[model samples]
Target: MANSLVSIQILPKTKNGENVIPYVDEAINVIHQSGLTYQVNPLETTIEGELGQIFSIITEMNERMIEMGSSNVISQIKVLYQPSGITMAELTEKYR
Candidate 1:
């Protein structure tokens, strides 16, 4: 199966103190619970996995953040599927 790349940008209600970090942590926790491998970037998060799992995890994270008091959560995604697996084009085609 090809891996899809996920980029998620999370902004909390506040930029300073533990406010944002807590929400970030909560979001990360959602990713972890999703059973997918991911990396945290400076202003974004990257997750690589199956298309379904990737989308599911991102949605879960966004919902979790909202439950944590985040008014707005934005997500961007890119999947790099290999020919042997599912290709990015295929994933997009399926979703689109």
Candidate 2:
């Protein structure tokens, strides 16, 4: 089983700054619709679920942001695998 988590930060340069919100909203909707749980913050969101679903949501979010005319919008996504819940040690094992 793949229990993964991801964090995304989107930065867009445009007059429609708020337009990015809908893209995130839609992503959350997809997660919710799929019966997964997630936490969202301004310009940042963390989702926990199967790896495929997590990536799928991020991809969809990117498409929506592009469709909304977000210029140079960049996404920073972090992925984690929770073997026994999340821990700093696991993070270090992956990155270090």
Candidate 3:
């Protein structure tokens, strides 16, 4: 079961100062491929999974940016961990 929620905003330094939306899309793709529960927000994408898996996904996302020709990548990350268990639905249920 998922025990953590991680939100991240990845800012990849594009070559020649180009637009980064494509790169952001690439990062999101990585999250999608993980098959974990995820929500794409305007500023950041939130993912729900085990802490270790979430961390590995984050690493892959950053590496993907580098492979995509980004000179450098900056990631803003936030995490919420509950040893018992947690889910995005549980956290946002009231709002929904």
Candidate whose TM-score is highest? 3
- Compared with the true structure, the alpha-carbon lDDT of candidate 3 equals 0.97
Each candidate's TM vs. the true structure?
0.67, 0.63, 0.98
Better candidate number, 2 or 3, judged by TM-score? 3
**Residue-level lDDT for 90 in candidate 1:** 53
Best by lDDT: 3
After TM-score superposition, the amount by which residue 47's alpha carbon in candidate 2 deviates from its true location, in angstroms, is 0.4
Global lDDT of model 2: 0.67
Q: Write one digit per residue (lDDT tens) for candidate 2, span 7-86.
A: 87866554545655565566567567666666677767777677787788777766766676665567788888775665
1-96: candidate 3 lDDT, tens digit per residue: 789999999999999999999999999999999999999999999999999999999999999999999989999999999989999999999999
Off by over 4 Å in 2: 15-34, 83-96
Cα-based RMSD of the predictions, in order?
7.1, 5.6, 0.5
The ten-residue window of minimal lDDT in model 3 covers 83-92
lDDT of 1 by residue, 1-96 (tens): 545666677665643334588888888888877766677778877776777777777778878877876677766555565435644345458676
